[model samples]
Target: MKKLTALALGTVMAVSMTAGVSAATVESKDDLKNATIGVQLGTTGDIEASEYEKDGATVKRYSKGSEAIQALLAGQIDCVIIDSQPAQKFVENADGLKILDEPFVEEEYAICLKKGNDELLDKINGALEELKEDGTVDDIMNNYIGDNIGETPYESPEDVDRSNGTLIMATNAEFEPYEYREGDAIVGIDADIAQAICDKLGYELEIDDMEFDAILAAVQSGKADFGAAGMTVTEDRLESVDFTDTYANASQVIIVKAD
Candidate 1:
């Protein structure tokens, strides 16, 4: 009887051990401290993921967010850190990938101009306010990102005077629904918002696409009037350029393998 009882207890211990191993989960951002994280180079995710690097985590930098997602799919990385909007795009198009229920960080998106350019800042902010007040900004965003939460259509305003000439917008066209290639032209929320702002201000709109990291340099060097690539304002960025009033709220999220 003693021998049979001891064998039953051993079997129970073995099953419990197996269950514990199978139940291991990564449920929160804190669980990823030692994970291999992927992020787009020079993005807010890239900036914030560095904090994990200091704590012995490894990071892989991709030139585009899609590249990071591809790496995640190929088992090259444990998870991806990216903006919530773009994360939706990637998750919808891929299998076995999902965004965590908890957001890693929340941020606001805005346009950036050269530091001390209060004149342009004031002009843009004024146009943005009018766009917000009359529901134009929300319309532009919903046009590309969808209006699942609510709905309101938009109407084009009358053309303003073009005496101020052209306003060049620098953007990275990899962020879907915010700034991505539609046919041969860049078309998305930022593109539409910049166009609407130019229309309101009476300036012809010109979009310039380049590497995401090159946008700030383009604005600062006078190559572009401003940047509107779903960019989030950060203290490090503030040192280089001033931001207009936030036009949209965004979040940084973690993409991990689905349980």
Candidate 2:
């Protein structure tokens, strides 16, 4: 009877071990409960993925979303959680990567500025509303995303006045479509939108590219007038900075190895 008991216990232990291994295979969202998730530091994805840590998952953060994708490709991470648009850009440029059809979370993108800068916030929000009303905001976004990408580039009004001075924009340029480097200039949807806002408000736009985590600090320290790297408005972030009205809707998505 003792020998039979030992054999049954061994079988039970083997089954448990197999189940543990399968838990991290990551076929879908449920698997993330036990998988290692990669995310860009200080992003919505990082915040969202941290929730899974309580469920036995590990969250690994990188300075850039592309770096997280690289880690996923290297087998160092089970999957990546990132903004859907940047995930699409990464997946299209690389092989063996795919975004899950079901989004991880829905979010809105907005411009952030120093807290209590209500005067500037009101002006920016007003300008943004005007842009949206005239269809300029849609043109700016469609220029960088969707089938009309690169075909509907936004242009500044001819010889627009800039009497309000220059407003420096802090951003992490590694996020494609929204913001990224092209040649020597940082050109993307946010860049153009900032320019449009400046054009409306009479302030010349000056963008300062920096690490994602530093954007808020830069704006708070008065180093940049505003931060707009596809920034999301969260209650946590709202504690430190003020945000303009939301300009665009976005999603957090999962990037897994292509099947």
Candidate 3:
């Protein structure tokens, strides 16, 4: 009877251990598989998440990161994926948002110019080189991004002159600090930088405030000379339009409830 009782206890312990392991395995897998990820439309974060999704993953696209973040908090999505800088800002300001330690993708941000606009491209490149050499790029980034997040500084490229002209820029006026409506004016880091480039090139600066997704179509249709509302340079975009040498780098990070 003692031997039979001991065997029964051992079997129970084994079953409990197996069950615990299975539960743990399921939890770990579900963290990734069951998550409904959010990303900004027309952003590399969106494209990357769509490409990287495993089986049972759901991806949601929003006009801006703020909208996606809203969805995340409402439990419409399990996670919000956006550029790290904005993610950090949101985490700092929002009640429930937190950035995950891991990044989904790393991407370079660039100005989108019309295909074959070589002269204007050259002037912009020259100014960019000067900015980098003279620490202007760093200063601008510090003024806007400050110590809030990490970003790579701009680099000058050898092929400076690839296109030319007055670059009409289309941007979404809702991405705070990057591009947003400040009272009556559309403003942000990208706007300031584009204005500076226009001043340097002796070209007229025309800015159009529109929806994020519309900017790309405006550029493609020749309604705008370029587009630069924190635009990410990606292979998919390269097929439709041309991007200058990367002016900055950022990554996609998750915004979740702070634990």
Candidate 4:
């Protein structure tokens, strides 16, 4: 009876330990090797997450980051991979969601133009260089996301020339801090940057909000002058469109349940 009691107690302890381990959330990238990773469709996060898909992991793509995050909350996915800036927004709004300390990938954000559109690329690059030199780029980013965030909103430049009619910008407005709707206006970092570029180039800026996956296609198809939704340049994208000089830095991060 004594031996049987000891054996029963050991069994209980083992089961308890196993349960604790199983209940623990992802704490490291390696932990994701066998996990179900959620990502926004056609995003760099989605592209990067594909690498792990071969490692016994599954990738689930949502049209919006919010949808992927919702799936995470509903227990439909083990984790979400998204851009760091928008990840902060989602993590702040959702209880029990936390970003891992280590980032999955670091990337530069740039404007996507139609392939072979060297003239427009040169103009954008030149304007970006000037904006960088004058600190306008930094100011715009701080206004939307940095220390000065939300204190002062961006106002369109009145001095810009509209002779060129409009420079249509393609974007996914669902990504906050990058591009998102405020009231009826689509406004954010990318919008401000596009505006600044248009101002320097003497053109009116117009934004078209659509799925992230379609932004590139819109630019390629001449439906939009450029794509600027926190877009990252990849070799795959390069094959389809030309990108301007990098305008901002971004990272892909993993979001998991806290503790």
lDDT by candidate, in order shown:
0.81, 0.85, 0.67, 0.82
Q: Write the per-residue lDDT of candidate 3 for residues 16-115, one digit (tens) a residue.
A: 2222111101122236556677788877777767754766667888876777766655556677777787676666655666776777678888888777
Which portions of model 3 miss their true places by more than 4 Å? 1-30, 148-166
Please give, for residues 2-32, the per-residue lDDT of candidate 4 as tens digits: 1112112223222322221222256788977
Q: Please list the Cα RMSD from the true structure of every candidate, rounded to 1 decimal place.
A: 12.9, 12.1, 15.2, 11.6
Task: Using lDDT, give the best candidate's number.
Answer: 2
Clashing pairs in 1: none
lDDT of 1: 0.81
Q: Rank the candidates by TM-score, best first.
A: 2, 4, 1, 3
Q: For residues 1-259, write the lDDT of model 1, one tens digit per residue.
A: 0111211222322232222121113568886677888899989999999998887678889888877776666566788899998788777766688999999999999999999889999999999999999888977777666644225434446656788899999999888768887558877789888988998888999999998999999999999999999899999999999999999999999998786
TM-score per candidate: 0.86, 0.90, 0.78, 0.89
Off by over 4 Å in 1: 1-26, 148-158
Give me the candidate number with maximum TM-score: 2
Of models 2 and 3, which has the larger lDDT?
2
How far does residue 170 in candidate 2 sit from its true spot (Å)?
0.5
User: 90 in model 3: Cα distance from truth in Å?
Assistant: 1.6
Task: Please give, for residues 64-173, the per-residue lDDT of candidate 2 as tens digits.
Answer: 78767667766678899999888887777667889889999999999999999999999999999999999999999888888877788888999899987899999988
Report lDDT (Cα) of residue 197, candidate 4: 85
